[model samples]
Target: MLETTMPALASLEAFGNVTDLLVRRAADAPDHVAFDVPADDPASWRPVTTAAFLGDVRALAKGMMGAGLVAGDRVAIMAPTRYEWAVADLATWFAGGVVVPVYDSSSASQVDAIVHDAGVRLAIAGSRAHADLLTRALVGTDAIGTWAMRGVDGIRSLDDLTGRGTHVTDAELETRRTLAGHHDPATIVYTSGTTGEPKGAVLTHSNFLGQVLNIAAAYREVVTPTGNTIIFLPLAHVLARGLQLICIASGMRIAHLSEPSRVVPALSVLRPTFLVVVPRVLQKIQAAAADKAARMRLGPVWERAVSTAVARGRLAEKQDAGRRSRAPRGLRVRGAVFDALFYSRLRAIMGGRVDYILSGGATLDGALSLFFRGIGVPVIEGYGLTETTAPLTGNLPGRIVSGTVGLPLPGSTVRISPEGEVLARGVGVFAGYRDPRHDAEAFVDGFFRTGDLGRIDDGGRLILEGRMKDVIVTSNGKTVVPARWEGAVEASPLVQHAVMVGEGKPYLSALLILDPAESAAWAASHGSTFATGSPGEVRAIDEPRLRAHLQPTVDAANALVARSEQVRRFTLVLADLDDHELVTPTLKIKRREVLHRAADTIDTLYRGAAS
Candidate 1:
């Protein structure tokens, strides 16, 4: 067994509960701008001071108390990410209630499942529609009241809560806030795990405190007072929630956009210093830039620039590890030229000030990571699960390994089991699921079984392999780890998702989702039409042109493994998967769901091709 541990850089020994984070922030920097909400003009933002935010939390907490919210009651927040989500969340905490975050993308059934499972008594919705959604979802369950953040649809609201709080006193709120201990459950986050039902992961006050304090301490340069960020990822995700708490703990300016589609406009307006993104979004940004270049007839020049950037990135990482010398003079000259011509434009599009970006939720394509790093923005990769609050391991600034998930963050320990499963024991790790039945299987000894297979490199960085449960064993007993091949083939600019499928079959095959934009651009350049189809549809292409284009990716993936483990054939599954049920809210493609949804197509893939 291989293990590594990073000692805690900071702790909450001075504070008793999660409420103290905000309370202390207000005490130390009352006038500090905690958040920036949109002003009259959507482009402009108005700052909310720490003291003002604290007052709002206090008023809301008092209202909860008046509403008969006893300590330990669960208050659900069903909203898109916005300034109000944080207010309602903190207020619930202050009232000695557990916060239950409902993802914005949750279906009515999903909403119903979470509400019933978590024993939620009240919900704060983002709008009238969300309030209605909550109402509809709660039909069969015990009545759960709704409070809207914005609307005049006769429903109670933040203002209503403020009005009701006049009868409650300061001492009552204080007593409630301090009732929960450091390790008490702060939130019951229902985790959207792949191939399974959602489980309520009980992250405690100290779980977040340990995560936030250590992140701030270790990545000090990235979490400074002048730093700012835009939150577009659903606040329901533990990673985003952790980021929000970290920003508050470190006094970073924050702006929230309700949707990821609006992020480009928001980034240009907010000019955030850093960002946390899922890999697909990062892929879109890279693809968008390339498509623009192709449209401008700069495809050849742009291709050369990308190659240069990738080379520079690889060389930089090698140099950092002392495996290579500085970038040669010729490459340096080419890089400088590309910086002026291409990289600068790309940076300007991302608000020109974003020095770095953090990626989790999925594995970033290594080539994509190199390309961004080459262009002067470090796309750092982190690894974790809902059970780990956020990232248990993260790539350190300036010391990033292009393909690795970096070292354990401060206050965490990572070990590889004899069979290669990654085990974690950390302050950020949740104690157990709300349903304790699974706890016996979830933890081995003291370390939480990550269910992921990986290893630690010579320099102590974590490099993930893939999910142990996701391994595909063919009929002939050839064990194929699909993620290894899928990740490799997904590096192509036109491929949105590369899902390998050949379980209990003769040979391995793949189900691919080509990106609409990138594929359209490719077809246009290659003098062919881009086929359009609705989601959940499949087509077997016999076209020579498409085959030739994707064959290189297959060949590349094949080169990584033994002959029997290679993907013999791949077919297209015409899906965008943006809001598809097969995809989680965080954009994780549920492989089992996708395969089950497209079973016939996989059969066709095996019947039709052998190359």
Candidate 2:
């Protein structure tokens, strides 16, 4: 096993607790814009200041008191990203209760699993639609009560709850706050179980406070008061929720969008300076750029422009004193030309102000990272899990290195085991899982086993290979790490999702999904015709035009791996993979689940049948 350690940055200092940061921000910058929620008028936005936000939270906390909520009580929120979701979260903390967040898109059974596991007694729903799911889950169970953020017939609204707390006094809330402390449980965030049942991860106020302060300090320039971000990921996700608190503590302005489909339109209007995203968003951006290039008939010219820009970007990063003088004259000329025609034009789509993108939840493609850097947008990839309070390592603002989750966080320590498993130990790491049975298998000598295979480089950057459980061994006794191959396959502009399959088999195989828009563009550029389908829907993959483009992508991916690890056969699913069944909400494929769902296809592939 290899081990490395880096001391915490000198500037790293602890904020007392989650609520303390909220109180300080409200008192220090009362008029600062805290959040901007969508207005019913559709053309305008509703801004909430820090002081006004605190008032709403305090009022809701008092309402909890009026309804007999006490210290250690569990409250669940079933909602999408919105202003009231923030209110409910803070109010639960202020009322000295533990908050349980449920994904807004979760089915009735999934909602029931969380509520029952956490013993949540009170739930706040975003709309009647969300409340309906909750009501169905709570049927025949008298332990839970529900409130909606928006009113419906015979239902209490959040506004009504605040009004009901009119008789509750400030002293009562203060008394409740004193009942909790740094080590007290603040939230019970569940794992996005891509495999088995979700396990509750109990994170304390201190865990959040430490991580937010250290991350803000490390990336002080990008996470300052001047930073503005629009959150589109589900708040139930640890990364999204942690970023929300980091923005609050750093006095940054934030906006919320519930629907993923609305992100592009919102980006054009919000002009956000930074973003918290997954690898899929970056992939989409790259695909969109390619589609636009194809539509404008700049096929070869577009590819050359991107290549020239990347060369210039890398040359500019060299620290040699004569680096600028050494740059070829032709490259400088092409860089300037492309900067005006291609790079600058692309920036307009993202409001032309995005400085950095904080990506997590999956490994990012190095080629995609450089492509964005070529266009003047830098993506800072990070690594973490819900058990670690969202982030264990992250790439910093000016020191980003493509394809590596930069140095470990200030207070965290990472180590690799003999079996190549990544382990972590830190104040941010949870004390233990909610289920005692998981603790033994999850911890080794006090370090929380991450279950991810990785190695630390000389620069202290963490390079993840793949998940330990997802590694496949073939009948020939060769081991294959699929994530390595999948990342390379995605770098090809033609494929959308790639899954490597071959366990206890003679050779590796793959499953590929193609984006319809991109396929159409490829077909057009290649002098072929394809039946245009509805926008964003999957098209039949067996068509000759698609097969012609996909073969090159598969070959390009094979060039990156050994012959034994290469995919010998592949099948195109021709349909969109359902989010809940084949993958988790964060877009991580449930390997076992996907393999099970496609058992027949696997059999056909081995039988040498044509796809």
Candidate 3:
């Protein structure tokens, strides 16, 4: 059994609770810009100083207290990513309430499960759309009072919630803020479980404080006030929320946008030093750049530039690993030329000064990781879940390995069990699930069973293979980790999801889901007519040209693994996953459920196989 632990840089013994981090910031640098709220002009954003932000939090916290919010009450924050969401989250903590974040995409049924499970007393919604959903979810449950970020037919807005506490005292709010100790439960974040209903992971003030303090210490250069980031991911996701806290701890200028579409305009305006990204977004940007290059008749130059970037990234990784000393001189010159001609523009697209782009939520494509590194912005990939306050392991700025998620975060221990399951224990680990029944299967001894299959590389980085349950064992007893090949194939823009099959069968095969937009782009590039519809209803699946296009992708994925583990055959489904439909709120596929639904298709794939 291989185990790795990164020592903690600091402890939270001096700090009473999570809210103290904000108070300290307010006291130290009261005028420093802490948050940038969108101004009336869509492109313009209004800066909120540390003092002003704290004042808002204090006011709202007092209002909640006046409105009968008692210590340890669970307040469900149901909303998209926005400024008010952050305010509500901090206010909830300040008011001695446990925040229960509900994804904007969550269905009413899902919301009902979480609300009842957490025994939520107050709910906050971002908009009328969310308010309506919250209203529906609250039906038949313990009657919970609801407030909206935007006022609705009869629902009071967050501003109204703030004004409700004219009688509440400042000292009372301070008392509530300091009430929770390090070990006290601060939030009950539900896991977006692929199988059963979501399980609420009870995270404490220490769970967050431990992560924030150590992470801010670990990346001191990047987490400083001069460094800043924007949050476009739903605050409901533990990763985004954890990042929000990290920024708060460091006094890093932070901003929020509800959707990915709104991120572009703010990028140039904010020029963030770092970014929060998902694998899908990385793939799209790469694909769009490639598509634009082709339209501009610079495809050859673009392709070569990409190759150079990958090569540069490869050499850098080797140097970091204490392998080769430096890049060949000729290669360096070529890379510089390409950087000037092509990569520089690509860097400019990300606001020209992004030091690193942090990625989580899913396994990023190794190829994409390398390409991005080659350009300038190294995708500092990390691995963790809601159970482990955002990151268990992450790559340091200069010590990145493209294909692997970096070393264990400070104060975290990552151990590969005898059965090859990844188990973790640390300051960041949550205080188990709200329901004790679920804890039995989740924790082994003291460590949380991550349910992921991975190995620690010689470089001490964590390279995730796939879910333990998702690993395929063929009839000949050859084991295969699907994500290795699937991620490679899905790196292609034309492919949205790649599900490796052949459990208890001869060899590995796959069910590839096509991205409609990417498929249309492919058709335009190929001079073929693209008919748009659902996979079963679309004629594109039967196109020989499309299959011919996918063949290289499968071949590339095959080359990554052994012959037995390679995808021998496959079929494409011209459909994509909808958030909370096929993909989880964290942006992971429901592999078991997807495969179960396609049982007939699997039979068809292996029907003519040789015994």
* Model 2 lDDT tens row, 381-481: 89999999999998776677777887788888999998889999886899887778878888999899999999988778889999998899988889988
lDDT of each: 0.85, 0.80, 0.85
Between 2 and 3, whose TM-score is larger?
3
Off by more than 4 A, model 3: 140-144, 319-326, 524-540
Ranking by TM-score: 3, 1, 2
TM-score of each model, paired residue for residue:
0.94, 0.93, 0.95
Q: Summarize candidate 3's per-residue lDDT along 557-604 as a digit string, tens digits.
A: 899888888988888775446646567887677777777667777777
**Candidate 1 vs candidate 2: which has greater TM-score?**
1
Give residue 319's error in model 3 in angstroms: 4.2
Which 10-residue window of candidate 2 scores lowest in summed lDDT? 316-325
Clashing pairs in 3: none
- Give the Cα error of residue 292 in candidate 1, in Å: 2.4
Residues 449-520 of candidate 1: C-alpha lDDT, one tens digit per residue = 999999999889899989998899988888877787888777777777888887788898888777767777
Supply candidate 1's per-residue lDDT for 553.
83
Q: Which candidate number would show the highest TM-score if scored against the true structure? A: 3
| Candidate no. 3 TM-score | 0.95
Q: Please give the distance, in angstroms, between residue 252's alpha carbon in candidate 1 and its true position after superposition.
A: 0.6
C-alpha RMSD (angstroms) for model 2? 3.4
